[model samples]
Target: MAVPGCAGTPPQGPAPRGPRRVPVSLWAVPPVAALALAFLYPLALVVQQSFTPDEGGTSLAPYTEVFASESFRSALTTTVWLALGSTTGCLVLGFVLALVIAFVPFPGARAVARFIDVFLSFPSFLITLALLFVYGTVGMANGVWTGVTGASDGPFHFLTTPWGVLLAEITYFTPFVMRPLLAAFSQLDTAQLEVASSLGARPARIVRRVILPEALPALAAGGSLVLVMCLNEFGIVLFTGAKGVTTLPMLVYSKAILESDYPAACVVAVVNIVISVGLYGLYRVVSRRAGA
Candidate 1:
């Protein structure tokens, strides 16, 4: 006795119950277990080794000895300054490039953006070598200058200095900053920019107010990444042969491989791991907040 709408509709069968979902937390166990085995276990082993003594019990003697050495102190200072300088340089240059690629209209703008991606795939050491050819005293600029002026040395001695390491670090890491920044820029609301422009807001003002606000997250994330990477950078500093620029990574290598001071090397390595982990945590927080 079904009515036109529903009054007398036949009784339907019971609704089919879908299979119960396993809690997502349960599903996450395997990956979490794998990560613990892969990462945390290794980290724990390093920490344990750092504490282990030659006589075979826990001791802080390694850390005490390593930190007491002036060479360790000098290497640490070099690591910190290099990380900061290179990160700052990368952020500034990368942000500007990202702005140009994202907002400024010009020929081959898209092509330039695509080229930035290529840099990430390239090995950082190659950039160091290329800089050598361009600025290493006997390289092109110097070669031309020497041929023209009969100079004994080229003006481009920075390549052999810490500043050269800085330059190489900046060049290699800028693309890291640019990649995140471009992604953030792409998600920005163009309408706001259009409105600002229509309202006669100057380009710099528009950038300062409308753009920079949205970019801070990417900046934080990228800068932290570059800082962490720079702290561990061995190839550029080593290849540049920069005098007195031994970073923690280089020191760790020298201690473990050359000097065979495993405990001391472990001390330095553990410190680096702590710093990198702290910065990475900061990066994760900022990136999540920014939805980047």
Candidate 2:
């Protein structure tokens, strides 16, 4: 019953698919390959160096030396205290500043915020230098106090002390904490606050029950970042730390530069990396819980 041309041919199956052609670009391969060579290779080298002996033997002698040394123990303790103090100070100041900026309208608020942003862009070293000029024995405060009291002694002897280092860290890292907290505060629902107010809830009650809960994640994240930064700090310490007030970074520097002990330096570096990683992990867990 079929037509003549149709009757001559049998039913055909679907056509077979051709192999997919992957684009091979020179651009794509070079970047990934170059990254492996540059970053990964260097990190691997350091890890190898940490484990291997400087004299061509395998050992954990450097780690033992680091653990047994009284100086290292003292330095580690000092570093922890410095980091904790700095982080705490930054959190308190940054939280208050962020709250004011977010909730309180004032003349030149925008300008003030812009000024803070610009200040953050300035070098930490420059700030340290300014602090030296303002706080050192021959500095402004010293001169003023001496003139007023007719005393030979300075008003504040925080220069080249742990307190000075902590102050510098808080000043530098407060911006980190403030920026995130400000964003968190800005994103809050004003309607909820108004509802609470209308219901005769005290301002303190509303902040405690609503605002803080909402902002906790951001606050924790910012605080954790500042803490980690303080832990790894070196520049401010170098400029401000006293003779016996050696932090972990300063100790590592001493070992590497002063004593020419690369292995011992590596041990301290590894310890720093471990502590940083652990604290960051803890931050992640807390942040996730707060968000949930």
Candidate 3:
């Protein structure tokens, strides 16, 4: 063996060191700080304002007054029913559409499925606008009706109603439900469908037996997300121009902007946050259970 420092051989320096890795905890600091500043800080301010009334002392007077108000109660009722109704519509419509797209082989079926991924990027206002173009007072449907029947005003006045808000919400949010379902459907075993078909199972039976069980987790995940979103949805309601359809978000806007009642606005905002956060936690628990 050569000596430690041979004449012909150049002695090796210390092995080259790669860059030192920062600890994961250290890596997390920037994002944690950013989140605290962007989200937590504002949320804390809002929560603080909710308790500290405009009269200057911290008290529950605002909450008590808001809770007792007829407008608050009406807004609360409208918000809950609309969110629930829209979520139900999205689930049923999304489930059926996902099944057809995933299972039923058809021309451009893949293209339609791909379009759904793009559709998710669309804003809620765009959907509401599109619905308005089709169904607004002087929109295409009414125009066609008026032109055909020589009527002064068409019967399509629902666009300014709560149902219009519901329709717009469903149209916009259904894609959210569909995206998760299509992903879940992709992972499903086609062999089960084939075997079920071979066993003389009817289409409904196969869907009910083989497919529904597997899709439950995705359904729960999508439904929970949709519920939270619908609860916070402001654009669709606002764009629908349904003055009578006062949601919690609208109430918050009305209180803060129109009435200049910042305390009441903060209280409503706090209540909305509590509901959304509670539902989001439920979503997290369900997602963990489903491994979704």
Candidate 4:
């Protein structure tokens, strides 16, 4: 045994500590559990319901029935077309608006951009209803035109057509595109643009070369978001009263609420969710690549 106070006793470095273990995985458990409770369980239920028809254990009968139905096919086709058209329209119009607000030196460009942001707070159905006020047969356009021109009809009857649904979706979703695009434009190296301008690159060519390439990632994100939303948009198409604009979401609503076909509705809902999730994944991949 060593003496307590003798200088001959070797100074002991801290008694060897047991290897420190970082419980890094403990941090992940809460989020993983939350994700399972929030997403996985609900999705499993939806998938199970989609497979069940007539209270049976499991079958693909619901999917088969939905695929065989003419209305289902028509609704899916219409939804795809409308989603594509609306996303493209939003990309074009939103890019132009964002460019003007970002690069163009206007007095109130920032103010206008902020004003456009207010649209995001408004419910989508409101935009459709507002369009009705402007373009409905007995609404403002018709009322004013008929009164002024002494004509029996109004100039705008497109409200009940596919054009109306497309327009409403674009109008509602363009700000989404604009918000991301303005962020993208804000980060762009204006020095590159200035150099292109000095080299006599025309506006359109400069946009095609320098601007569009840089903007593509933001465009992908915005377009994916808009496309997914438009794919599931019910209020805009329904409120517009567009006969040709029934989307998959509208089909799900009608099948469940009007026709009481819960299994078919679940099948359609599952498809819509799959598409939205897949597009969201693509957006993530594009974002990562752009960052790299």
For each candidate, give its TM-score against the true structure.
Answer: 0.85, 0.85, 0.92, 0.87
lDDT of 4 by residue, 90-187 (tens): 99999998888988898988789888888789999999999999999789989999999999998898989999888899999999999989888989
- Clashes per model (N, Cα, C within 3 A): 0, 0, 0, 0
Best by TM-score: 3
Supply candidate 4's per-residue lDDT for 154: 88
Report the C-alpha displacement of residue 16, candidate 3, in angstroms: 11
* Pairs that collide, model 2: none
Each prediction's Cα lDDT score? 0.91, 0.84, 0.93, 0.90
**What does candidate 1's lDDT look like per residue over 1-292, in tens digits?**
5565587677778899999989978988999999999999988888888887677889998888888999999999999999999999999999998998898899999888899888899887899999999998789999998889998877888988899999999999999999999999999999999999999999999999999999998888789889999998999998898887899999999999999888888899999988898888877886788687
Where model 3 places Cα greater than 4 Å from the true spot, the runs are: 1-21, 287-292
TM-score result, candidate 2: 0.85
Question: Ten-residue segment with the worst summed lDDT in candidate 2?
Answer: 1-10
Listing every candidate in turn, what is its Cα RMSD in Å to the true structure after a full C-alpha superposition? 5.5, 4.0, 3.0, 3.4
Ranking by lDDT: 3, 1, 4, 2
Q: Where's the lowest-lDDT run of ten residues in candidate 4?
A: 283-292
Candidate 4 — which pairs collide?
Answer: none
Off by over 4 Å in 4: 1-22, 283-292
